[model samples]
Target: MNMHNTSSPVTSKPEELVPSRYALKIGDIDVMVVSDGVLPLPTAMLAHNVDPSARAAWLKEMFLPPDAFDWALNAVVVRSGSQTILVDAGLGFDPDLHLPRAGQLIKRLEAAGIDLSSVTDVVLTHMHMDHVGGLLVDGVKERLRKDLRIHVAAAEVKFWDAPDFSHVSMPPGFPDALRSAAKRFVKEYGSQLRQFDEEHEVAPGVVVRRTGGHTPGHSVVRVASGGDRLMFAGDAVFAVGFEHPEWYNGFEHDPEEAARVRVQLFKELVETKGLLVATHLPFPSVGRVAADGDAFRWVPVFWDY
Candidate 1:
C-alpha cells in the first residue's frame, strides 16, 4: 500500500522542551522510539509476587520512591522497504483512570512526522489498553486508511473473548478497564485484523512473534537487516527484570510463565547482541543485554547526537 498523509492543521501548542523521539537504524530498517509519556503507578506493581521488604530494598538501591513512581510509556515506529509499521499504540486517554501523563503517542507520532494514515501496518504486542488504546483515540480511526492492517496474535484475540484475570494482581477497576479496551478494540477493528498463529512478517526485515506470557498472545517484534538486530520486546521485559527476572509484575496474566519468557528473551539478546526496547522501560529505552553472573544486566547504548 502507498502510505501518505492527509494534511491536518498545525495547532498553536508550544513545542516540548525535551526531545520525545529517538531515531536509529538497524542496518537497512529505520526505527524511531517515541515517548507516549509516563504512567505513575505504585512501586508494588513492579513485583507483587515478592515480599514487600525485598521490593522496598530494590527500590531503595535504585534510589526510587518506595510508594509510587512513573513508568515510562513508549511506542516504536519502523519503516522498511515500502511499509511503515507501528510496533504498539500508546495508552490513549482513559477517563476512569487518573493517568494524565500517558496517552501521548498520537501527538508524539505527529511530532515525529508520522501520520495515522501513513501507517501501513500495526503490530500489537497484545490487547492491553496501553498497547492498543491509541487507535481508539477520538477520530484516530477516521484518519487512518481503511485498509490498515492490524496484526495481532490469534491466541490473544481468542483469550480476550473470555479473558482470565484470576492470575493477575492489578489495582481496583483496572481489570474492567483493560477488558473493556480490548473488547472495544476488536469490535471497532475486527475487519482489519490480520491474526497470526505464531509469527508473521509485517514488513521487510520486520517480524513479530508471539511470546504468550504477559498476555495469552503477547508478542515481540524483531527487526533484522544486514548484520544488525533489534527487538521491540513489548511487556516481556522491564527495568527490574534484568536483576530479578523471577519477580512478577502486577500486570502479568501468568507470573511464572512471564518470568520464564523474560529470562529466555534476555539470554537470546545476550547471545545475539541485539538492541532491546520495551514498552514500560524508561523513554527512549534502547539498550543491550549482558549476563551479570546468574542474573542479567541492561547496557543502554550511548545516545548518538
Candidate 2:
C-alpha cells in the first residue's frame, strides 16, 4: 500500500489522466481490474474508533491529505474459458451527478478491448449505487449484453426490493432510489436474474460467497483456476480495513457486524495466502493480508510493468 513516496506533495487533479485498466493472468483465467474513477470520501465520516492523531499520521504516511480520502471505484472482469464474468457494475452513465471523477467504467472496459456483448454473466457483489449503477450504459436498458445472466444474493434482492423504512436513515430520495433500482433490475433482467442464499457458483471457476454486514447480502467473489486464487472482496474491507478491522465505515448496515466479518475475511486471506482485490482501495487494488499482532496489515502485490 505504501508503494508511493510520502515526501511528495499530492496535487489535486481535475481528472484521472492515467490509464484506468490493468490485467493479469491467474492460471487459465484472465482477470482485468477496471476503474470507474475516484470519489472524495470525507475522512471524519470513516474515522470510527481510530484515534485522531493516529489517523492523521496514517494519512500522512500514505501520502494522502487528511481532509478527503480518494476512494476508487473498481470493477473486475474475469474471463475463464468461454465464460466472461463481470463482478460489479460501476457508477453507470450519469452526467448530472457532478461527480465527474467517476462513471468512466464503460469507456475503460471498451478501451481494454472487452466486448460488452460477450459478457456471459454480471454478478453484483452488492446493490450500492456505485456498484450497480452501471447495469445500464448510456441510458439504454438492454445495454447489458443480450445473452447476459445476472447473479445476486437472495437476501440482497429481498432487502432492497422491500427495504424496511423503519430504523433506516438515508439522504432524501435515496431509499426510494434504492427500491426503484432494485425493482427495475429485477423486472428488466426477468428470468435472467438468479438469486441464491449462501454460496453460489456463477461460473466454472468463479464462486460468490455471502458475507453480509456492509449490506444485508454483501458477498465476495472468489476466482480460482488450477491452484491460483483471488478474492474480489466487494467492500468487505477498504484501504485501511486490514490494519484496522474494527474501524467500521459509517455507511455499513451493521457497523459491529461489518467489523467482525472484516476480521474473519482477513484471517482467512492470511491463512490461505490469497490475493485480495478491493473495490474501494487504490487503483489496481490487488494485495495480500498478514496477521500483525491482534490486527492485520495489507501488503499489495508487486505488479509487473
Candidate 3:
C-alpha cells in the first residue's frame, strides 16, 4: 500500500506522464484496477534486496533501469451488473507521498465512465496513501460521495479511527492530506460506514476475508462469478515478477506475519485457480499463481472484455 516516498511532491501531473493502464474481464464480472500512474522504486536498492540473477534478468527483460526501479500503482475496480465497487482508491494529490505520475485515480475512474455519486460501495482493505488516495478528491471532502457504502474491516476501523492512530495520520508522518480525509470520515460520514470482519459477504458474490500481516486489520476481497473467483490482494506482493512465497515488500509493517499469510493464501489460490490481483504487480494486476520450481510464479494474463 505504501510506495517509497520523497519529501516533496512531483511537479509532473500523472495524466501528463504515464498513460493509465488497464486489463479487464472475467466470467460474469468485469474487473480492472485503473492506474493512478507509476512510482519510481529505487532499482539498485530494491535489486540489492532481491536475488541478483533474477534482478539482472528483469532489468534486461522488464525494461527497468539498472540503477533505478519504477512500479505502476493500480487501484482495483469491479463491476457486476449494476454493482460497481472500487477496492482501493488511488493516489490523490498528497504532497507528502511525493510521487511522479501521481494523482490520476479520478481520471482513470472517469475513463471507466463511473460516476462518483453512483459508486454503490467502496471496500477499503486498509488505509494507505496509494490504496485510499482517491477516497477524497484533491482538497475537497464533498467531492467524494458520503452516501456510498464505505466498507471497512472492523479491525481497520478501530485502528485508523482510534485516537492513537494520529501518529500515522497526516502532518506527523508525511500524510498531512490524508489526515484531513480521515478526520472527515470519522466525523461527518460515520453513518455511511458499515464495518465488516473476516469472511463476510459484502455484495452478492463479493466477500471480504482477513489476510493480516501487511497491516493489523488488512484484508482481501473475493469476487465470485459463474464458479470463478478473483481476489483483490492489496499490497500482499509488490513488483510484477514472482519470487519465493516468503517474498515481501520492505514497507510492510509486519513482514514475517505477511509472509505467513502470503504462503498460506498462495497455496489456496493455486488450488482454486483464483485470479490473483495484486495492487502493485503491474497494471490490471490480473494473474494466476503457479508452482514454479520450489516457490511460485505470478503468471500475468492478458485479459480483455
- On TM-score, the leading prediction is 1
RMSD of each: 3.2, 6.0, 7.4
Candidate 1: deviation at residue 34, Å? Answer: 0.6
The most accurate candidate by lDDT is 1
Writing each residue's lDDT as its tens digit, candidate 3 over 1-305 gives: 11111112456654344445454555677666677777665554332345867766767786766765556677777776777787878767766657757668787666556566667778887776666767666443466566678787777667665423321212234444445556655565578777877767777788878777777678888889888888888877665335654544544556677778887778888899988877777776788889777677888777543
Each prediction's TM-score versus the true structure = 0.95, 0.87, 0.79
- How many clashes in each structure? 0, 0, 5
Model 1, 1-305: lDDT tens per residue? 21123223665874776668888889888898889999998898999988999999999999999999999999999989888999899899999998888999999888778878898999999999999999999999999999999999999999999999999888888999999999999999999999999999888899999999999899999999999999999999989999999999999999999999999999999999999999988878999999999999999999875
Q: Write the per-residue lDDT of candidate 2 for residues 132-225, one digit (tens) a residue.
A: 8777554545555666788889888878766654433344455666666667667666687788999999888889989988888999999888
**Model 1 regions lying over 4 Å from their true place:** 1-14
Best-first order by lDDT: 1, 2, 3
Taken over the whole model, the C-alpha lDDT of each candidate is 0.92, 0.78, 0.67
Candidate 1: lDDT over CA atoms? 0.92
TM-score of 3: 0.79
- Collision pairs in model 1: none
Query: What's model 2's lDDT at 123?
Result: 90
